[model samples]
Target: MTNFPNPDENHASARAGWEHIFRGGDIPPRYRSLAEPNPQVVEWADTLPAGGLLLDVGCGVGRHVVYLGGRGFRIAGIDISPTGIRMSQEISAQRQIPFEGHVSPMTALPWPAITFDGALSTSAIHHQRRADLVQALAEVWRVLKPGAVFIADFPSTDTLDYQDMRTRVAAGQLTEVEPNTFVDESTSPDPMEDLFLPHHYCDAADLRDLLRHFEIVRLQADLRPVTTAQGSGKVGKWVVWARRPMTT
Candidate 1:
């Protein structure tokens, strides 16, 4: 059996680490590249009703909020890091893109039930442990209207980082909090790579199990080459397009 950190401790640690990273304002170049809207998200969102209200879960720095808002969507974003929310608001202001932003965790969205017409998350929900991920998805479900379109991405276990972390955990160099969940303890001169937090990886089976409540429209790997200041490699992500059921 694998040992896991106390749930409360794990959550607190992740929140603090992200807060520190965002507060430093030295975001890595790789992350900076993410300021642009994801093409897949844009394509999926194009199907949404024009000018409909949308919610962005874990909207780090509001990349999607700003981009989608500019495209004429009424968008709001939420993140656990106050600095992230503040920076997103500042950027939106600078660009004159009107959007709402709030500081909160994905597991506990501040919005009322069925308040959004559509919702999305990118590269964010996988930051939690399995249980927390479930709660966060439930919160997303709670806020979305019946039959609302929802899309999100999860880190794939096939990624090089996941393989490296598996090797490290086997060598006892890193702790495996759960089956595919790990506490990132590796050090890096690059502040971007220095994030110390829990990273959860998933596969197709995991996604199917986790999203059983939704009507899955698409489930496929989002493969792309990524170059960072430290090195270059490919990242494999499981991008899922799902819809909230029309009832219950």
Candidate 2:
């Protein structure tokens, strides 16, 4: 088994980085552009039972919560960053949409078992080492109802950042604390890019092993163009739609 940073250490670094980003006055345009609901999320959400209770894990700023809540789905969200949760609440309030938000890490959700009909996460979850990722997935599983759908995206090994990290690790310039996991140390002008957070990239086999408990509905690679202070490029991710088994 690969050794990883202590869970508390990891969570503390992540929380501080994210809180700083959220508390800072306007987020980067790259993130601001994501205000719209992801098309893939919209498609899957449409198939869920009407007005189903949903949980948005790592729902920074509550974009999905507000959007889905407006569509009549009862939605709650959780994030490790308190500032992010505050911003989410403020956004929901300004829109007059009811949103249940909490400050919590994914590895230990504050909800009860079988509390959510479905769950979704985006641009999150991959920020942990493998062990924490597993714990977080188990928490999601524990809180979801049987047959509940889950939609999430993970950074792919093909991403430029991952490739660069691999090269640096090989050159002994950086450490791969765990397989395909590296602490980002970019010096880009974008605060989001310079947060020095851990990022784990996964391949198909990795995803399969990570999601073995769920019945996968769809798994595919998605590449989307993005512009950042560093430059413009495509971001690669593996998007998955999975369902919990009705029977244990």
Per-candidate clashes, comma-separated: 0, 0
TM-score each candidate.
Answer: 0.87, 0.88
Worst 10 residues of 2 by lDDT: 186-195
The window of 10 residues in a row where model 1 has the poorest summed lDDT is 186-195
Q: How high is the CA lDDT of each candidate model? A: 0.81, 0.83
Give the alpha carbon lDDT tens digit for every residue of 51-140 in model 2. 999999998878787889888898899999998898888888887878889999999999999999999998888878899999999999
TM-score for candidate 2, residues paired by index: 0.88
Among the numbered candidates, top lDDT falls to: 2
In angstroms, how far off is 77's CA in candidate 1? 1.1
Q: What is the Cα-based lDDT of residue 169 in candidate 1?
A: 83
